[model samples]
Target: MAQERRRRPARGHRRAAAPRPPEPGPVLELEVERIAHGGVAVARHEGRVVFVADAIPGERVAAQVVDAGRERFWRAETVSVLRASPDRREHAWPEASVDRAPEQRAGGAEFGHIAMTRQRELKAEVLRDALHRMGGVETGAAVEPVDPSLAPGVDPEAGTGWRTRVRLHVAPDGTVGPYAARSHTVVPVASLPLAVAGIQAVAPLTRKLEGAAAVDLVAPAEGAAQLIVRSAGDRRSSRGEPPTIIERVGVRRFTVDRDGFWQVHVGAAATLTSAVQDLVDPDRFDPAADNQDLYGGVGLLAAAVGDRFGANVRITTVEADARATEHAGANLADWVGARAVTARVDRYLDELVAAPDAATRGLTGATVVLDPPRSGAGRAVVDRIAALRPAQVVYVACDPVALARDVGLFRAHGYELEALRAFDLFPDTHHVEAVARLAAIV
Candidate 1:
């Protein structure tokens, strides 16, 4: 039976901006300031951010723009550079990193953005701006980019595949693709450049497994990516083992499991892990210390740092969904350090003041690294963390809004923003990974 759809006009909601026809041309020239949330530059045509791909700062290039509404800004691509910036002349993607991986497989080419190295600085600046300008976190000094140490490289800001898993939506036509910018249109590609080498290493596995309802490519448990192509209604694909392939990173490679969580970009995994480690100072995990892993998705942070830090930190790997925590425990079981005690974030955090273990994780310089969902850390969690007054706090935020919100909360707790950094892990999309290190003061 075909699903019936209901049509309701916008009655109470504010109306979207008027739409315009796509500009006809090979490309039109426009001045680009900086890249927006997406990879395109934030150029103003009619006082709005005109996102332009393949364009960069200080360059005036020709672009073909398609009108988007209030939330859906204009779409544009740089066609030609009528005015050139010196940086673009010498700074190109392939030239910088020979293994340059891009969002799409047109081949890892450079956008007009001249200096990717400088892009990191800008991201750090944005953090400070958001904190000082938006969140009033500038009590002492404005937030600066995380020291170069936090950066993945000398540039310290440019990020690439350190992903362990990727969720590529299966289109109606059985075509797997990424959504174009914010648009629902699926943009197909021969292959993704930013995909961890391990994920890419197993493309042949797709040929072996057909009729898969959903293919989940995960770089699980600090090892190579394991491809678990699942089925929606069928039973066969669910039982199969992950494809046999070992993706290596850092110094070692572990056995890939069909079900596991690995950083998608193997190269950037160590950097991210180190950042998490810095957040909690996993080095401080004492055998007698008591801490909790709020979202211990696969226990990567817990196992990586907790084992070294010790079980003294009575750790609770809280996850409302029990299945995920079971896997997390299994993954971390071998570690001699603290283990995850089950707890739900919402309920547990709500009763923190009354909970006995609150003292265990209670302030006294305890560290908490809050990596929440896209929806971001809620008010209760934020308030609890603020009250606990942890000595050091590290936030691995995937979204800018939540990060901005929490920055305000942390500021209230007397935590100063020591380091703020952004990673270009996704390369082409508006999405970027941001890590903020907070230190508590008097």
Candidate 2:
């Protein structure tokens, strides 16, 4: 009978159970086997992988599990070193030393405890491994130091005081300092050894820094240091227009917003410019072709191309930031054929893909230089760039794994790696910059 039909439970009617909290665990004795990407050492416990921080490969350390919720892996930090690697040293930044409690150590100097030479060697190993495993391309590229001549009066070997940009955080209670390693908790510190002298002179580390949520210290190569304080709810905006600053790479000067993006190391700009110049052969540069720089910041790499070719060289710098595009227009004003367009790179390439035959022909023999962010140019962007069929592509990448993946995608599109060079731009850290030249298989 119809009256006998009972009401049934609706979909999602029952409340789901909450996830169980990760168990707090006893400290473990672990032997680190090798270094992995992102400033962590690989160790295994109970047949599961554990990423341990503050420990070097070939060392035994007692660590505390910070996270164990994941079924495949756990995260830990070294509490005490039972057996240290020969390459280990007193950390360059004492405040970030492993001797400190896990939650108290400063971030941004994850590799500070290792010797500089060994640090570069480890970076090289990481790069080569990524290229081989992910990109299927074998590389012997070593992470080299920025040339001493580029940064005169600075000690390159010391690997300290090279950073021209530094950011500090302010807690809700108004205490200001660098955030703790792997956390947003601000840890007050006495000194910032990685910052250049100019930044150190104006650092507001000891002050209360009231009414501000963050501070940006910028010390351009040719000018006095500038401190920008950002309020709690302001995001990146200010009262009026953000102030602009002048940055010098060799004799040429660039106008960059104080809040704009720039290479942090003093010599990074020059080193990259030189590397790009060396990678692009002058004879291959077609002045009539539509050369382009993707994610171009203030026309730095485009200027590198102009420096290698003539001022009459045809090139366009595409950037998402309007302010950076404005600066790029001014910076590249000397080049008659150079223009800066404000657009997302993928959209810009999409426009190129749909262009008329005459316009598309300009891209066929062109050279494309892309310095993508840490995420690197993903699969979609790589596919778009490949469709353009540029004669040559210069890829400047900061993350090894991302670069390797994109390189693999390019390989599938009949593009071959011609050359690759890595630079130790961010010393005492797991970060490395790589420049690769790829040519179409004709």
Give me the candidate number with maximum TM-score: 2
Q: TM-score for every candidate vs. truth? A: 0.69, 0.93
Candidate 2 lands at a TM-score of 0.93
Q: How close to the true structure is residue 319 of candidate 2, measured as C-alpha lDDT?
A: 86
RMSD from true fold, candidate 2: 9.9
Root-mean-square deviation of Cα positions for candidate 1 versus the true structure, in angstroms: 8.6
Residues 153-262 of candidate 2 have per-residue lDDT tens digits of 45666578889989888876778899888777789999989888999999988889766777878898667998877675554544688678898889999998776777
lDDT of each: 0.52, 0.85
In model 2, which regions exceed 4 Å deviation?
A: 1-24, 235-237, 358-362
Tell me how far the alpha carbon of residue 130 in candidate 1 is from the true structure, in angstroms, after superposition: 2.7
